[model samples]
Target: MEKVRVLVVDDSALVRKLLSAMLDSDPGIEVVGVAADPLIARDKIKQLNPDVLTLDVEMPRMDGLTFLENLMRLRPMPVVMVSSLTERGAEVTLRALEIGAVDFFTKPSSDLANCFAESAQEICAKVKMAARTRPRPYTQVQKIDVPPRLSADAVLPRSQSPGTRGSTRIIAVGASTGGTEAIRVLLEAMPPDAPPIVITQHIPAAFSGPFATRMNNCSAMRVCEARDGQPIQPGHAYIAPGGEHLLVMWDGAKHVCRLHDGPQVNRHKPSVDVLFRSTAASIGAAAIGVLLTGMGDDGARGLLEMRENGAPTLVQDEASSVVWGMPGAAWKLGAADEKLPLEDIAARLLVLAQQPIAGARRAAS
Candidate 1:
């Protein structure tokens, strides 16, 4: 098998060296060269013609985002951003993603060496996944090796009975990899009065609030990072805050949002499985489960549970997905009721939400 060639670009010599070492540790990856800044990276990219590029957000000669914009416009290829875990870093990194970068990871605020070493596995995995993706021109947009993972059972137990019925319907969404943009596109098309939407997108704690704010700016529905005990209501979308799992629970009168700061499920905090399973247990047939583009099978089992409980479930088709791992896994497991393109998902969701809950239950029966 051919090794995935990589170029490490960071202003810090230490960061570049650390990143290069991380990529080199993976047998499937080869670090072709290292650049201290985007100017050097530009030349190395031309010379090395690497399959993937690891870029830093801040650079001396040219900023990472500016270079990224140029690269996407001129010669689009997969690029993974290494950014800081700060409010400014989150804002800039989000812009890079919108400008067509494949994915991003935040560098630790302190103890750089130990933190980078600990996250080496995930860093290399993201590079490997980036190489396989077909990056688009100024259009937006993983961890590779599957280590032992804990399932939703780690946080929430599987419900033995069908979900309790509710008067109104809810939508459960899960995505990763290229999810930020996918979620944006889906939300942008929704009407102001759309059904309540609860989302789980793999993200770091600092980025979640900004991501929700960004989504709110684009979407007709009000989008905010979910709060514990918050009522689930129409015309609003709740985003699972980073580092915490978002779940739905019956509040006697209606379904309400619940946040769990528990162990990582499926190697992810705010895991898709936790949210989907919670929706399955709390709303049952009164909910719709939509699995979008992501790198792992985190949401597959939970989506299957939702389907088993008679909720309409759909996945973004491969052609429209940046990475099909999550949706593909769900489809292979017979979890989804339909596989639709990204352009059609919002319309289909609206239709499904309008369907009677009893009709969904009877169909499942």
Candidate 2:
């Protein structure tokens, strides 16, 4: 088996060394070279032709984002960002992903050595995943025709039935790996009056806020990071805050978002499984569960539980997934009620959300 070649680019000599050691420890990966700045990294890329690149957000000669933009435009390849756990770092890291970077890792603020020690396995796994990913180029700006934005009331016209504004019907979505772009694409096409949406995207705490803001800017529905006790409402989407667990719970007669800090479930805080299982327990048949592009089976069992409880489950098809691990696992486990391409998921979800509670129950039965 051929090993995945990697190039590590960081202004910090310690970080570059630590990253190289961590990656080289894995038998499947080979540290091809290390660069102190983007200018050096650019030359090393042409010279080494590595399969993956671990890039620092703040380099000396040139910033990571600018180099990433140029790289994607000129020679697109898998690039994973190594960023600090700060607000500014989060914002810039998200921009790198939008510019076509494959994934990211957040460096710990304290105890750098201990942090790298703990994260060795994850770093190796992500690099392996990145090697398999083929990042799409963002060279030219393309104009898309967006429909006139509709309010929640307009999106979900009140039916004469019992499933009205306070309806427990909701949408639960989960993703990782190529998920940011996948989620953006899914949400951008949705009507403003769509059902309440709760999402779990594998991200760090600092990045989630900026990610939600970016999503909101492009999407018709109001998008924000999930807050503890925030009321779940139609025409609004809630994203699970990084480093916390986001669960939907029944608060009196209405459902509300609940955020809590807990031990990592399936190696993820704000895990997809945690959110999906909560939706299954709380809303059951009234909920629609979607598992999008990701690298692992984190949400598969929970999606199965949702299906068992009578919720409709959709998985993005392999053809459209950046990595088909999550959705593919769900399909293999018989957790998915339908397997659809990325483009079809939003429309299908809208149709399902429009069904009255009783009608949805009947269909499930």
Question: In model 2, what are the clashing residue pairs, if there are any?
Answer: 152-193
Question: In model 1, where is the ten-residue run with the lowest total lDDT?
Answer: 138-147
Give the Cα-based TM-score of candidate 1 against the true structure: 0.95
- Per-residue CA lDDT of candidate 1, range 1-365, in tens? 89999998888888877777767877889889999988888999999999999999988989999999999999999999998999999999999999999899989867887777778777777888899999999600023345568999988898887654676889999999999999999999999999999999999999999999999999999999999999999999999999999999988777899999989999999899999999998888889999999998999999999999889999999998989999999999999999999989999999988877865445344
Winning candidate number (TM-score): 1
Cα lDDT, all candidates = 0.91, 0.85
Clash statistics: count for each candidate: 0, 1
Q: TM-score for all predictions?
A: 0.95, 0.89
lDDT per residue for candidate 2 within 1-365, as digits (tens), equals 89999999999888888788778777889999999999998999999999999999997778899999999999999999999999899889888888998899989767887788777777778999999987888602122233343221221222222222235579999999889989999999988888889999999888899999999999999999999999999999999999998888777568899986766777778788888877777677788899999988888988887787778899999989989999999999999999999999999999987776644445334
